[model samples]
Target: MTILHLALADDWTAAVDAGEYRVSTLGRTLAQEGFIHACADLEQLRGVAGRYYGEVTEPLVVLAIDEELVGCPVVREIPEGAQEAFPHIYGPLPVSAVVQVTPFRR
Candidate 1:
């Protein structure tokens, strides 16, 4: 299994096309933890920024992760070498464009 952290909707869509079960955002499901706001349009992301946190003025960024390929327990404790590649797009990311399949959580 491979967990792919995406910074854009297209990224997630591409993964789906490639035959993967992408986990909806944390906002969509409670079992899925974290916040990702990336959308087709930049404005949509900006509009929803407030819903995620208070006292916000500028647009926010969001991303999605492929949970099925990613494997269990949403959260993870990543290692150092892998950490450099997986820059946190939003909250704590489980994978990245360059990195995947970290030590599983839970």
Candidate 2:
């Protein structure tokens, strides 16, 4: 299955160079947040983007991760104040697990 993570263009570039991604969300890291947030579908991705990245003007990209290729655990859990569950990767995402990278537009 494919899961999507919204990422800053620069971060993604860094991940490409480093071989792994550790950002958990905007302005946060995997070490700080403990997991990398991901969307299960495009609709969910839209909601997350609107809520967290609405005012940001920086270039963004969507990393389409192939779950089976990810070495870490992918858990589905509801975050605080949310009615639905989101996929959370419990370790740094390896760049090799990302099947596609698409530019994001608001």
Candidate 3:
């Protein structure tokens, strides 16, 4: 299965150089958030982007991650006050697990 993560272009580049991704979301680190948030589909991703990243001006990229290539655990759980379940990575995401990185348009 593939999970998608929306990342800042700079952060993605940093991760590429560092060999692993540690950011959990926009301004939060994995150590602070405990898990990296991901979306199961494009529709869900759009909702998340609109709700959380709408005001951001920085360039963003969408990371298409191959679940099988990820060494850490991927769990599907509903966040508080939310009905839909989203994929959450339990540990740092390895760059090797990312199958594709596309510039985000919206």
Clashes of each: 4, 0, 0
Reference-based lDDT, residue 44, model 3: 87
Q: With candidate 1 superimposed using the best TM-score fit, by how many Å does residue 8's alpha carbon deviate from the native?
A: 16
| Candidate 1 to truth, TM | 0.24
Q: Global lDDT of each model? A: 0.35, 0.96, 0.96
| lDDT string, candidate 3, 9-89, tens digits | 999999999999999999999999999999999998999999999999999999999999889899999999889999999
Give the alpha carbon lDDT tens digit for every residue of 1-106 in model 1. Answer: 3233322344444544655423444334212634332332224334334334345333322443444433334444332543322212233323443233222111
Can you give the TM-score per candidate against the true fold? 0.24, 0.98, 0.98
Off by over 4 Å in 3: none
Task: For candidate 1, give the lDDT.
Answer: 0.35
Candidate 3 overall lDDT versus native: 0.96
Q: After superposition, how far is residue 60 of candidate 1 from its true place, in Å?
A: 6.9
Ranked by lDDT, the better of candidates 1 and 2 is 2
